[model samples]
Target: MKEARPWLRPDRAASGGDIWKKMKTGAGGACGEDEMSGEKTILVAGTWDTKDDELSYLSDVIRGQGGQVLSMDVSVLGDPKLPTDVSKHEVAEAAGSSIQAAIDSGDENTAMQIMGAGSARLALDLWREGRIHGVIVLGGTMGTDLALDLCGALPLGVPKYVVSTVAFSPLLPPDRIPADVQMILWAGGLYGLNDICKASLSQAAGAVLGASRAVEAPTFMRPMIGMTSFGKTVLRYMVTLKPELERRGFDVAVFHATGMGGRAFESLAGDGAFAAVMDFAPQEVGNHLFGGLSAGEGRMTHAGRAGIPQMIAPGCYDLVDFVGWQGVPAPLRGRECHAHNRLLTSAMLAAEERRAVARSICEKLAGAAAPVAFFLPTAGCNEWDRAGGELHDAAGLSAFCEEMRSRSPVNVDVLELPCHINDVAFTDAVLARFDRWVAEGVISH
Candidate 1:
């Protein structure tokens, strides 16, 4: 019987060192320019031990598919900075020869954790620097862990492909991988070049490179507008505000008030990506005040501080989002709660809670651009806040509105709409304010 070959053996006959030298030169060349090679490149990177041949083979396939391929070896050198390319000897030298140290014998879990952290950091650095257009990985179960670590590190638009021997087996939790990742099942291990490996990898390379170069919808050059919503409260604005702003040549981005959505909205706004804000349902404030799910961390109005024209509305301030009736905290249980669906439950705020919510809201909106408006719909903010829904409470609404207005600074105009927020009149009114701001150059047109 043939002896099983060690996975760390190098094909020394090949001039892998020359490739490493070229890579070091190319890295400097690529970093100086905002754009990369006219043709997209895929970085085929992995361990530099016995896996060096596999990297070379995959890089060859990608290059054949009209892509420029760069190689990376994930070995930590004495400096701990990644080399643009590294040879097998350099890798072995960097990582000590103890196979035990490399194997991560703490447990299967520990092995996965170690692989994920290292691979993810390397992939993130590569992608962030725009050195790679797409990524493909070929590996075993441990490889799968590392591959996904790399995959998850890529930004939302970039493509990631993984060909793993265990893809068809039930040994690992697929949930460990992201839903957007592309996975292929490879029979046995990827030892050498073969028809199936070549074909699949070729297709993946073409798919990623092709998509990378495809004509994308031209970026919306007009100012971006970020808004907050939930499936329910902002339903009206989704239909009305989005198109209205788009017609006026402002790019619209809507974010849910769920924990991260509001934060993301503020982040993009502060980053100067968005020119203005139409912060419509801020139910996250209620969540924050009443100990409910979907609570946006404080700093909700940081966008206004960046000098963006903005409008704040108490679209669904009456309710705090919860997961289920049982999930409602003890203090909030007696309050009026509505089950919008199995997934989202909300509680109506009492006057006292509304006052606190109002103060927090006022604090966040401190420095919005001139002509900023804070509107309240007297009839209702959401369907639940109307005449007969579970959240309906005229006195509660009045207390909330009055408190918010009294506490907030004069720059935040307090407007009262007679109709429900979804009413066409309300839409027209909000659009009119948006138009006035743009026309006045309070926000760039």
Candidate 2:
């Protein structure tokens, strides 16, 4: 049997505060004592066999800054000079495989897939056990690939910093990245540690540790309601709904319905974090289907899959958002357009497109495992689409409403209201159903 490492020795484990004491008085020079109440334990993970020096530098910097290190080796073949708290063999086994099996596959992608799966599972376990507060990972591409999965495994607000040679590259898509993760470019240190690379690594260490110390994790004391909307300029219902929901003994979290914001909303919903969902703004659904600025696939499906009661509305569903900086898409080039800003723009859909969007919306809602209420504000779906407004087209609105009322699944209760989406009457209708649901035990109080 191999001898245990010093950090994992039974004696050291029994000394509850030994890790913090040693971190404060470690060999490398200490920065001053942190005013924070407790020492943070940061998970330093990487392909340790190849980038041992870089990973060591990060660990040292974290320790020097009054933080404890939990080193995890994700290497496939070679061993690090120092023992890791979590070994490569252990990581492989976490994924129900072995290092030899990964090597025998004879493919770098295959080996890294095994490592990534193991790393994600171990990282999630560490977080759940309260053994780690933050994570800082280093890699060129393979390490970065594994880093995305590891970060995704943790809930939002846990500090996740990635130092990678391919940081911010096009190779990393919007869907692959977690909403709150921070990434720094690993310049000049691909092969070995240099001054340039050291600068990036040290900053990442301090940032993750500092964030861990400052972060206030969610308490989840109050049952939460998740809602989606654009800014008040377009969707004003949230302005009225947020305070009202709070008064009713529930916490409301309203997410911006842009690409990344919607992605974060879907992620939390997939985790079953919300007691119920008021997913009013589903423009990202049309965006994804039409090759516009998407919130990734499966935008409006998560809460339903989680079996949470849903109140759905077609807020801002008439327009599809795209990257304004890239010019309009070829298919939507000759349509009425509104430039929200330099980064985002919206184009009005034709009547046929509106019917298609209605069909798509009904199709997605058809899979609801729980009850669904679809509110069709017949006057308009958004401020700009109301009568006499800039993008208003009564014909288009009729097309969408007619298709929705005709084709919605039986599981959905299609309420055709005669008010604009931003009208007080519309808000009252939503509140009426919500209150009835709570009273009838369909929604939890």
Candidate 3:
């Protein structure tokens, strides 16, 4: 079995590495730009120690479909029986350790973790080198874990597909899954390849090939605007703001305030992906304040740390998000709430909780190196938080506005408008402030 093969065994008889292997040499586009290769040089990554036969079959299918296959052996157990272009030793080295260390540790889970991290780092390097056009993985569980790690490490635009028997299970956290990651159910793939496995495998092959062949959207030269909003029923500012930015030639990116979406937005901001942020919906801030899932750690801080021009609004600071699957937390039971859907339930926040949200936003913005604006629409922050609405609480809204005004940095402009969050006037105010920032040379015009 491949699991028992020697790690250093020479596939000396196999074709040379140049045709089937990829790694980072790192000459990039103009001024450190990262772009995908036009070639369909897909990486076929898997735990080859136990799944070499399956991986080899998949490679042949990829090659038959006109993809240049870069077979990566991520198995830490031992060598692979199949002819692999990228070996376990390479993956180990990328993780700042050796395969021998993983073997000597004698713990399967630990070894898998090391291999997974190493592979992910290596995948990024290869991607930067334009060596990886897409990624295809064939695994059940451990393989799927590594595949996800790799997918997460790669930039969002790259095409990634995983064929797993346990794909899309609750075992995987939703936040860890990139918005574009695709998975195929590996039915009848638990053991040897049956007709069922082959059918699934064929479909997976087609998907990666098709995605790699598709034309990549041209990137805009305009400054990117990172906009945040949630269910339109609640935070409608994004709807009104996106077009206005586009009309002025700024590329607008709207992130839903789901647990994963909020995390990704802040992450991209920190990575220098946006020129400015129009943080219109901050339900995620309330989520962090009131113990909810819609926000991950460090939601509002990244843009400030990136030193980009930004405008902050309490788009949905009145509510905290808790999915119906988890049921409301003990303290939140019987509180005013809205079930946006069976999967998403939002609990109304108290005045004190809204104050906490305001303080958190203030704390994140205190470190900003560029200009920042904090706006509160006095009429309401969201759809149901308005007068006569289900989640309306004038005191709660006032709490945020008052705290934000008092605690915001001296240089930060904290303003209030007598309008709802979704109102056109509110949108106009945010855009007008952005224009001032650009004109002041705070944000590039």
Best by TM-score: 2
Winner on TM-score (2 vs 3): 2
TM per candidate comes to 0.63, 0.90, 0.86
State the lDDT at 420 in candidate 3: 87
Clashing pairs in 2: none
> Taking the tens digit of each residue's C-alpha lDDT, what string does model 2 give over 193-305?
88988899899999999999888755455667899999889999998898988999888999988888898887776655666889999999888878887898789987787
Candidate 3's TM-score:
0.86
The lDDT values for all models are 0.63, 0.84, 0.75
Candidate 1, residues 1-445, lDDT tens digits: the string is 1111111111212221122233324432223245643777776656544455555666776677678776655532222133445332333333333224445364655544454555565555666567776777767766676776667655434567777777756574433454346777764336765777666656665666676565242133455677888774435767878887888876787887765566556544543445677888787877876777643465465566555667878878877787774677787878777777787777778877887888888877765544578877778888766788666788888888788768988777887888888788788888888778777766675
lDDT of 3 by residue, 21-54 (tens): 2111222211124443444788899988887778
Lowest lDDT block of 10, candidate 3: 1-10
Judge candidate 2 against the unseen true structure and give its global Cα lDDT, from 0 to 1: 0.84
What's the ranking of the predictions by TM-score, best on top? 2, 3, 1
TM-score of 2: 0.90
